[model samples]
Target: MTSPGGAAGTRTDPTGTPHPDPTWGPLYRAGAWSALLFVLLVLVPVVLVVVAPLPPTRGAALLEYIAQHRVVYLTELVSFVGLAVPAMVVFAAVAVALKGVDQSIAAIGGLFGVASEVIALALGSSPQSLHGGLVVLSNAYRAADATDRPALASAAEALIAATNAVSWAGILTAAAILLLSLPMRRASFFGPVLSTLGVLAGAAGIVSEALRPVIGSGYMLYGLLLPIWFAIVGWKLLHVSTARAS
Candidate 1:
């Protein structure tokens, strides 16, 4: 059942050593199911971040979005648990077939990211980072009203710093593992370069979050890099796995 491409799956590395593919390989990306999930992973946060930058004339909308965040994040939790969580288990079920390096590492990344995400959520952004910085930013009206209370703003900024630190730890660890496994030719290629970007982005985000007074977008944006890159890696993995399978 080996594919025609000389079994890149079985092909030895430059050192002439064979690396076996995983049992189940990459998931069959039939439609855009994986892509949709990827979008969901990235898009929800994007929406949340966008909403944050918006004025609070839309308090109702912001609240709605927060509610939506619960839904999306909860869904994310379930999916990660159901689909992504047990990836590490070396089970004997009919699963985990043909899992190559790409699938293996990408799966690891997803699970890592998800675990971190859930943790960050459990802590609550405000409690971790600036208290209600997101809320304040999202509601321009609130921000405008609170302009006189610089102390609240400082407290909020402090909160952002704290929360983002935790968030970045997860992301940075995940990125390191995923990217290092890629073994790409160039440093700028998608899979190979993504981890680097993830590391830098995650670091920058942490720094920015920690030093709110210095003023830089912290976790506010570090997240943006992982989803798009990691998502694409997830999608690309199937193709790679499929090609190997064929």
Candidate 2:
């Protein structure tokens, strides 16, 4: 059998191949931090804004709520827009870290992950558009007569629905990262547990997202585990990489 790649003093298998090196600690750490940022900056804000009582489902209630909470909606829109940059960094870091183990899988998986995120961001609401829509709604709510309110409410619903459509992209990104775990299972840098968890979590996550419309939000339980898994894997990668360097 061929040896895994590693540092000068690293032990080799019976065939005299060194283990794969975890020399990419910095990249892993960066990936971890970026992933955490996605949780904090993008995910958290989304959850808060969505789960909040900013608007009830009824038409007049929703209009009144948006009029009262325009700032909150504006802030959430800005947060979503800002997510694109950190998301790119997170995917790129993951790809580089994976490259340290297996290059081909990393390239393909990483490219797909980044592409998924980009597509989601592109197809989703833009900050300016969201902000503009909110401005129009707020102004219309304040100035429009009772007869005009229905059109404004319809516009608001359309905007919210458009934003919600991007949820699939998040699932696709998770699936792409999990694909790299297939190689991680065999690589010396990461063993069976991480890879196994990656696959399970990824699969569950994909299912959760796919069934979300049907389940009516129950899938978030599985969805929430995704970031936690990422954080754990990232932490392990950082530790192992630093250890290898020493």
Give the best candidate by TM-score: 2
> lDDT per residue, candidate 2, 1-246, as tens digits?
223553333444565533433555566677767766766665756676567754454445656766787777666766766666666766676666556456777788788678877876776454213434555676777799879878887887776556444366767766776787777776555678878887877787677656655665666666566666666665665565566442
> RMSD in Å for candidate 1, one decimal?
9.1
- Stretches off by above 4 angstroms in model 2 are 1-26, 46-54, 58-60, 78-81, 124-136, 166-168, 244-246
Tens digits of per-residue lDDT for model 1 on 61-148?
A: 4333434354543433344333322222211110122223344544554455455545544444421222234454434434455554
Q: Which candidate has the highest lDDT of all?
A: 2
The Cα local distance difference test for each model comes to 0.41, 0.63
lDDT of 2: 0.63
Instruction: Report how far off residue 95 is in candidate 1 (Å).
Output: 16
Tally clashes: model 1: 20
Question: lDDT at 62 for candidate 2?
Answer: 57
Which runs of model 1 end up more than 4 angstroms from their true locations? 1-22, 26-36, 45-118, 121-199, 202-215, 218-221
Task: Give each prediction's root-mean-square deviation over alpha carbons.
Answer: 9.1, 4.7
